[model samples]
Target: MTSCDRFLLDQPGGTLNHIRPVPAALFLAASLALTGCSQASSSEASSASEDATTSASAADFPVTIDAANGEVTLDSRPERIVSLSPSATEILFAIGAGDQVIAADEYSTYPAEAPTTDLSAYDPNVEAIAGYEPDLVVIANDTNGIVGALAKLDIPTIVNEAPATVEDGYDGVAALGMATGHVDETAEVVADMRAEVDEGLAAAPQDRLRIYHELDEKLYAASSHSFIGSVYDSLGATNVADAADKQKSGYPQLTEEAVIAADPELIVITDQVSYTADDVANRPGWENVSAVRNGNIVTVDADISSRWGPRLPQLIESIADAMASVKTPVG
Candidate 1:
């Protein structure tokens, strides 16, 4: 099955604006939806009352946070935290906020126990999420007007943008840790991730090998500026997209001619569901490419490679292993 489109919204024309590379919902509107039910039902009313009481008590709050939503003030430690971003959810759980996370968007399938809801990060229904009674909601990508909607509901939110570099990933983890009162744990997690990356790099082949990262079967590629490219860089793979003749988005569409000419030594295909090693090799002119001729194309789990969170160590190791396993290109 095709990966669910995360945050992209259709424009007036047929063209698609590629949003951030994660998750599909924003939840402040869900809070607004719950307001109506709380008034009509006794149990709901009690829950709402308890939430208000908690907010009023202010347990070591209001914590002022600077995020994509600007400065957000939290009146208390969030008891019911909803995560709309998969990466944010992963980070939250990594920093020991899993017990506090009451709900997450449909895409947060990791950790197995994350309360995955029908909520769409891209088409978030405010009432649906508000019903969960979240005190705080964390979003990785807010391209779908979620921040403004949550702002209108007076709901606290932390917007974590997609990381472009490994350092950015560490920063995101640190921010989520601070938000969830798990500062030290977050630091430890970041340190561990950094160490893993360093180890992967240390073991990477000293000789540079040209690589092409397949974002999709359509030949869309990730440049060095992308998170995947950072991983490949750590493994000492020279990304051909970074040296492409035609420049486009960080995730660029490469023509068959261009890719063939680049003659990448290794092809890392993230869209494994659609393409296999043989499938890639069978492509019309791909037989001439060094990767295809030498069977150097590697298929990776899209989930592990795409999401930037605690699993980054796994991703780095996977790429490094692929690099180590590929046969030397025959001249």
Candidate 2:
């Protein structure tokens, strides 16, 4: 199964770009097909209409936002918002814009109250999205010229692509809040996330722990350059995958020998659909590894780990907890 995808695009020459990591062979194919279809971003229309607004200051209406696609102006609060990006959907709801959302993509499954439809995030149908008649359509990754198509129909859309770092994530959250006319709410959310992350970093063990983050069973790993890896880096944890990411693609495929050589102190499994911590421990020669010997294995939620949404605090907490759990810290 695939994990939550990040805002990062595929590396040149067709490398896996999704937040989900897979074997090198699999990554090539998926990445080649995954992000290649994105077309030119639509500039979008300015000045939202009444149907576009729900609950917002009248002064806030006719607001203009500079986004990934282009400059988008909302004349009024967006009462009917169609979210095609799961990350965006989460931010929308977290910033008090959930009530304004009319429909969301299939993968936006965080808030049970969200009106999740069969609309595909991977293969979005412009007609289906437009059918919602939403005044504001928000998308993350564009495919098949979705932005241009929507523009052709005079449907205003905003491209709030994925963030590559925690700060970028915060920016996106703030942007969404402003977009939905919840400026104060977005500011508070960012402040809270910052406080939680800072607190988590403060709680990290003084000794630097070598971390091996298992993206999947195929042994695809995330490097210090990766978004998830950035979290570990902030915690003062060392990423063993940094060595494997020779090209600095952030995502890399590691051989068994590479994993053994790294000999990480903590093994963080991002997804368990293909294998479990026990399965990793049982791998040939893995039992001799420091993490395996010390029973220092942490399995994290794939959804929470992958998306850089409001739940980002939770991921940091999980990693910080793992760091705190290392009883016999390696010298």
Candidate 3:
């Protein structure tokens, strides 16, 4: 995943591993990176077939999935799982498959019990991953063709690419449950998310406040089309960056003049940014901007803002709190 606001580029997994390329490539790269490596080896297939005889039937033995990378077939439930994607790690635990996960990348910090290691999700070491001897490896990006490398060792993998839309996020939750044998839990989590998100967004202002989502200190912004921007859209907010996203690339770098010109009613700065709320308000040309003048700026957690995972409700609630501050209209 290249950083779309999160530098999630070639950030093939976890939350961001953005591909570090042209703007248009961000969306396409994420969807395409995990493709073409969804094959199961003979040993895995033989093992799956054997398990079917123990107590289950064929219906549950050979499950085929159209994952982010391509078509992947799992013979049996994944026992030792290694998650390279931050987003995937969160899903694995939330769906009640935490016990099945043997290891995860260092970026998987939530849940506290996650087996985070020295592994780098971006620069993944296949040998190190192999040391875990995971029955299944999950990733968001192909990253150095690790899929093919693991496949050579008879290891099965599923590419759980980062979500591009709200629905995509739901689909990912369900998919992980399927992969880890937690179908029932997945349903409950998705239902809770949908209901909470609906209730949270219902509290947004009906008049549609103009919002700005800061990606970094360089002034890169998330457009209305981005996954993060979708949260604001669900609340009926207008994205000030939408006008400047000439390429419709979902992420756009803006000039200071453009941000002030838009005069957004709410400015959300990611926590990763060095600039504080006061710094934004003190900028020379921002003195008169509504968000600056009215203290409508919100400092957001970068990880939560960037990843489309189980904690999505937190994002909705955070935005709701910001909306609550807009009692009448600061602008």
**Can you give the TM-score per candidate against the true fold?**
0.80, 0.80, 0.81
- Candidate 2, clashing residue pairs? 5-19, 7-162, 47-75, 48-74, 48-75, 52-77, 52-78, 52-79, 53-77, 62-75
Better of 1 and 3 by lDDT: 3
Q: Write the per-residue lDDT of candidate 3 for residues 84-134, one digit (tens) a residue.
A: 887888888998989989999888887799899978778889899999999
Q: Cα lDDT of all candidates, in order?
A: 0.68, 0.72, 0.72
Say which candidate scores most in TM-score. 3
The prediction achieving the highest lDDT against the true structure is 3
Which ten residues in a row are the worst by lDDT in model 1?
Answer: 9-18
- How many steric clashes does model 2 contain? 10
lDDT of 3: 0.72
Residue 9 in model 3: shift from native, Å? 6.8
Arrange candidates by lDDT, descending. Answer: 3, 2, 1
* Model 2 per-residue lDDT at 184: 50
On a 0 to 100 scale, what is the lDDT of residue 72 in model 1? 62
User: In model 3, how large is the Cα lDDT of residue 136?
Assistant: 91
What TM-score does prediction 3 earn? 0.81
Worst 10 residues of 3 by lDDT: 10-19
